[model samples]
Target: MPDTRQPVAARRTHCPYCALQCGTRISGTRADAVTVEPADFPVNRGRLCQKGWTAPGLLAAPDRLAAPLVRGRSGRLLTATWDSALQAAAEGLARVRDAHGADALAVFGGGGLTNEKAYLLGKFARLALGTSNIDYNGRFCMSSAAAAGNAAFGLDRGLPFPVTDLSRARTVLLAGANVAETMPPLMQHLHQARLVVVDPRRSATAHRAALHLQPAPGTDLALALGMLHVVITEGRLDTAYIGRRTTGFEALAGRAAGWWPERTEAVTGVPAADLRTAVDLLTQSGDCYVLTGRGVEQHRQGTATAAAFINLALALGLPGTPSGGYGCLTGQGNGQGGREHGQKSDQLPGYRSLSDPADRAHVARVWRVPVGRLPGPGLRAYELLDALGEEQGPRALLVMGSNPVVSAPHAARITARLAALDFLVVADFVPSDTARLADVVLPVTQWAEEEGTMTNLEGRVLRRRALLDPPPPVRSDLHVLHGIAVRLGEPPEHYPTEPRKVFEELAAASEGGRADYSGITYDRLDAGESLFWPCPATPDPHPGTPRLFLDRFAHPDGRARFADVEHDGPAEDTGAAYPVHATTGRVLTHYQSGAQTRRVPELAAVAPEAFVEVHPDTAARSGLADGDLARVVSARGGMTARVRLDPTLRPDTVFVPFHFSGDGRANLFTHPALDPLSGMPEFKVSAVRLEPLPE
Candidate 1:
């Protein structure tokens, strides 16, 4: 093991990938000459994932953008000064708004943005651009879980307790989350627990489980319902806790009453005996946890699926205690914070509703603007992207911190919509696939060159200290936003370029809402205080809330509500024509879109490109062999990948990592069917067919 002792002059910060946000220290003054060592953080202790250890490579990547680029009259991107690029972007956006309407301008954001950046981007879209069309890629990440958590508990903070609390759990139920690969450091907390994994693929996490329930794709809802049915039938309901701390138990029980093990097994493809075993492990526990990830929450009924699991947790009386609870394994680094601030289409800072009169009034006062000037809620991420350049949609767009070209569902469709736009601007440190399509690409500072605060999956806000200065001609996203706001007729004071000032404004804006951060200051964070949120300021230096709902749920009556959720199968079902299910996820070596990790030679050499995970039985049935190039075609599009046979995977299911670009992009085949409540696109399961491609 490497020495973890703090080196003199080393800057303390957090990882740039994943919500673990493992504490890290960099010990060099230059971007390319830095070495990263793990710090003693509560979440990951002193361990860092491969992606976190090799993150500095992103700073010195050979393809790092050095200067702004603008499309000239010849329709080609050429080097341009910051002044000219900002001018072109501002004027183009203004032209669209003047010709069509304020709604003709849109902004797309990402989950990786800092709290300050997320706050300012939402403010810029509303007060500066005077448009309501703003949403981030987090809608695609965990909106379903957010919606369900809000409905059931009246609040959502990913995990309601510090990640360290999981170490004492006797039973840990990981539904659709592969923590062993996605977040290896997190496995430290689960080693003492009796693990139960639910996934179609025998992921690395599943392999470690005492019991693995391999249900068919899109049947997670049914599996959860089956577990609840067993719990109720076996008389394991926590009646005292339920009567005291919950409502709607009878309705929820009635909904699950019909889903006996046999019926559930027929739909979910899990044996009735195995379902009973899962229930036994969960109920016999001293402390238990139920956590859901993207696998179950990316379906058309994503919200309902999450609520079903929440019902199970409540029935078991697991939540609201110090020992165990229900939570969502948030994917992105700032996914929890990005959506809490004003980045989501229907939200304002503090997780306030956009259409709420009181929420509008409070935020308007914070911005020093009239409440009447605040536009109503706009379209969600997929809706906004699908409507790009259409007569009824925004003609111009500004994208920051996301690469939708390879990440969005139905890539072919999103690509066409992007091409149809009148003007496009992308702010990024690297020439990502999305940046190559922009009318103006503004080179921006990366994680190591910027200082800000990011709230991790556990809801702890950590300070990100800059280790080195950015290269010449490259600017920070805050500076770029301030420039554009000034060019578009907003005062410089309204849009501060400094991260501290922006955070101060954010604190005020989020002072009274659900995910309040008013009491959290840079002083407390920099002083190494562990601050989880809903930390209100007016309460006279209140201690930060590391554990939530210890006494009561975040509801008016202080009782959790059990959702009457039911199982609705996949949006698209398998048939003779398309008889297989295809799923997408991340590999250990890469993250969303492969924007940074792919640049690291060490990571790329380990998992250089995308490949399809096929069971040997399925391969032989399709007349394909291992290492053969095959085309996986769905109703929307097709992507080619090398076939790797894995006997552990379900025979009817094929898995592909959604990190590569071009013909290897997994999202090309992902269906755009959205959950009615959360607007989360169905990314977990799609009906697809496989065809052999000759070498």
Candidate 2:
């Protein structure tokens, strides 16, 4: 930690990283030379992980894109002036719209983008390009949890209660969330709580827990069902809470009917004794919480699995209670806000659905356009990318703040589809792997160079202050959206170059809808009080909601709905040819895609390359040894990674971190079989065969 005994000379800001959004003080005269110290924010409470400590290096990365580039007739990217670059991008999109209809033009966004940028991207796609193809990277993050939460609780806020509330919990069932490595600072709150973790490998988080249940990959649904079965068999159900505050109990009980401990043990590979012990722990524990992460949310049955966890929490009557609740730890910095806005393929601002006539009329009225002008829902992220080169797929694609080539499932296919596009435009601060493939790459301002708001995992909207100015010709995303819309012959008054101005319009657009932010403003955020959403437009201003489902649910009848979900195995089953189950997750030192973190010399040094963790028996069976290079072959593609032996993991499973590109890329082996309800790709489970390389 940097010494803070000297006088404070930096501006307070939030980390430009994960959904934790830890607070920091940034000091720098130029982009390259900067300093950071932990800020006294409630979320992390003046603590930061290695990623946050070294985040300052991103501002000064030598390869940052400071000037726009356009591909010329020589098939090479050439430096272009701002006017020429914007004109080229607009012309390309316009050409696609004119030739193949508006649906042939598409826009993709990122969850790291500020709330304002995400909002404008959706509106620009609809009003400027007049296309229905608008979705973001969050479909890859927590869409399954969002879908399941909505179906079960009538609404979705990543964590309905504040992070500080975790201190009040006595016991927690942490599933598939390796917060110890992913969000280290959050571990401070868990030290006092009795934790029960479920993972294949002995994860850092699993090691710290009181009880660790090692289930097979893609068997989280079965594990949860087994626990529920124990709760029912032991007569530990909260019949009072269920009878009073929920419905569909009979259906849920019936779904978990056949999933006794023995049956669950057979499917999940977890011992029946361990399942019974976990159930007993959860039942006996007071003020308990059940939380999940991508491990459970990034599978083919992700939605059903998430529903199972929520059902477990509701059966214990944990929602809206202090320190005890169900939440899907959102992956990206603005993922919660990203999904709440209109950037989703089938959503409108304020989390309204595009399929609803009332929601369409409400948003159309706010945008000052006829309701009929708005297009219907388009394809989800994976489906949209898969359609890129097809006849009905988009011909020209505009991307912002995302690096899909390194992050999306089936990376080889996405790269090829991007290569086949007639036009590709990317607005990013760095020359990301995806940016290197663009026809036009526009230099854009990053976190400290731009002013906007971000909603954290708790659904708390916080302001991201600008601490320094960007170099000449480097523009903000708001500037790019406005410039492009104007060149497309859209009304000038419709697009605002200023973030606050755009947020003002956005607040009005969200006034009467769910996920309401009407009462929040820059002024209120600066008022030294923590605030959450559903703050309706008012002068007196009610405090933002930090808790949900206290008295009634968001649904009309004022009762939380229950999902009668059933369990299923993974999309791809292991066979003789591919006998090992491969799973992917993030390492402690890297963020998603590693676009920014990899640029930091220190962070890269900490996690320089990707490697696979294989159990001792599996390693021996495959002839792989510690520190040996292995080529992992899956149904879709293959990647070479170093293998390390782990005795703790399930003998049939292997683990890989999905950070690096090229030979170490993990997404190359992932399956795009989506949870139909949420459109989330199954990134957690894949069947593979390993081949060791000769020394």
Candidate 3:
């Protein structure tokens, strides 16, 4: 068993990496770096990943942004004073607003930002700039799961129950999530649990599973339907649960009617026998969960795939139960909270819809603005970025925390669109590729040097305490946005520089909304006691809802929903020209864009650069070998990456880590096709051909 200690040290904080948000302590601080020790936080039980241990290297990184940068008359970014930079930024944004109207001033945020920053960023876009064009990079993470969760459960918190509940489960049917590589700290929870993993590649997590169902890329929906088909044919489903707890069973049954085991095998390339075995493992256990991540959520039919999984879980009497259900493994550090607090295209402060009159009225009262003053739904992340420089699109962009050049699907085109922008400003702690392209770059404080709250994958809210002040001239993201808002004449009171105060206002705005955090405060979180949301502001605050749908879902009908979903396959079809299916993921040593992790000497030494993973059979066919330079090509673009042959991968598929930029960015060849409902780009499946680059 893990140490599982509660935080007893000074300056206890969460990791600055993925959504695991492991507890950490600032063990020591020096002029050059901050040392870290694992804290006994509940999530990880005092464990930290390599990236977390060396996260402080970024604080003292040689190239870390410390001053403002402006594109001077000579066409080069030159260091400038805060006043001059703010003046230039204000003048540029004002010019764009005057020429193209408010909608032209778009804001793009990141999932890594704290709840306070995310809330303020959205408020800044609508209340200050008064633009309807605002979204965040989180759209690329698992927005499909979010859409599916809302459609089925009427609410979308990454997990309906706390992650600790997984430890109590007898089985976990994990799909497409490489928890071993991406979130190793979470593996402890599954140490004693039987596992069933689904993926095209034998991912690290899949390799540890009792059963690994290797499906073809982008065919998760078909596989899910097949499992449901088995559960239906074998009488493993609970008809009573289906009738009482959920609706739309007949619709899903009608759709699953045609997806028999044989048909599913042909479509997904998973053996029919193996599929039945997977169903057996799931049905054999009273406590079992079905979870998914970006692999199954980054396709053109991502929402449909997610819905199919929910239908399967609900049919098996899993959801709304004690220790078994479906959940989405949220990616970015603050991906869960970031989406909850209004940075999403269609949401208000509490995951409330923009079109909902009551939601708008409540949030408007918090902002002290008219209900109608808030902008309506804007373009999703991909659409907003793709629409830049168009005739009727955004002319100026304000980016906070996100480094999209290396992270967006079809990043080459995104970079082109960004280049065409009349004006661009990026706020970051480092001078990333995206920041370098900005007309102005503002330096900001990093995670350890900031104070805020983050909601983890379990929907538990945890506090991030400030350890030390950033080097002089480095401001927090809240401060940067506040400065820009003040320059634009927005009142100072509305945009507080203090994180706790911003969170207080955010809580008020979130009152009565779906993801209510109105009752939670920094005071309640003082003793390392994290709270859940939907915590209504009562005299004695609710202990935050750790489990949802036990009594009722957020649906007006007081029941969970199931969708009649069909498999549409991948948006891009494989052909003779681009015969191989290419998929991308992250490496253990690097976070989303490698902006901070890449700067760390230890992490950089472990995984110095990007590489493509190919099966031995595919490598033989292409006359390629391990450690060889290869060019993966698609109609959109091509990227040259070093090849790492893995027998665990499917022969017709190749994998690349999407961390590095420039010549090695995997997003260069990814398809830009968006899911019809969610507008999430198909980053998981793409038609591509490969060739060896001569040594």
Candidate lDDT values, in order:
0.93, 0.88, 0.89
Candidate achieving the largest lDDT:
1
Q: How does candidate 1 fare on TM-score?
A: 0.98
Among all candidates shown, the one with the greatest TM-score: 1
Point out the worst 10-residue segment of candidate 3 by lDDT.
Answer: 1-10
Determine the C-alpha RMSD for candidate 1 after optimal superposition of all C-alphas.
2.6
Candidate 1 structure quality by residue, lDDT tens digits, 193-285: 999999999999999999999999999999999999999999988889899999999988998999999999999999999999999999896
Itemize residue pairs with steric clashes in candidate 2. Answer: 32-60
Q: In model 2, which regions exceed 4 Å deviation?
A: 1-8
Which runs of model 1 end up more than 4 angstroms from their true locations?
1-8
**Cα lDDT of model 2 by residue, 146-251, tens digit:** 9999988889999988888887778889998999999999998777888999888899999899899989899999888888888888898988888888888889
What tens digits encode model 3's per-residue C-alpha lDDT throughout 1-695? 11123433468888888998998888445443467889887779878888888887876688878699999988899999988888888889989998889999999999989999999999999988999888999999979999999999999999889888888888888888999989998998888878999988888898799999988899999999999999998899889998898888987888888989999999999999998999889888688999999988998999999888889899998888885889999999899999988898899999889989989999999999888889999999999999998898899999998998998988888999999999999998788999989999998988877899998898888899877767678788888888888889899888999999999999998988889999898999886556887788998767889998987878999889989888988987899999999998877898898888889999999888778899998998988999999999999999998889899899989998898878888999999999988888999989998899986
Model 3 stretches astray by more than 4 angstroms: 1-9
Rate residue 559 of model 2 by lDDT: 76
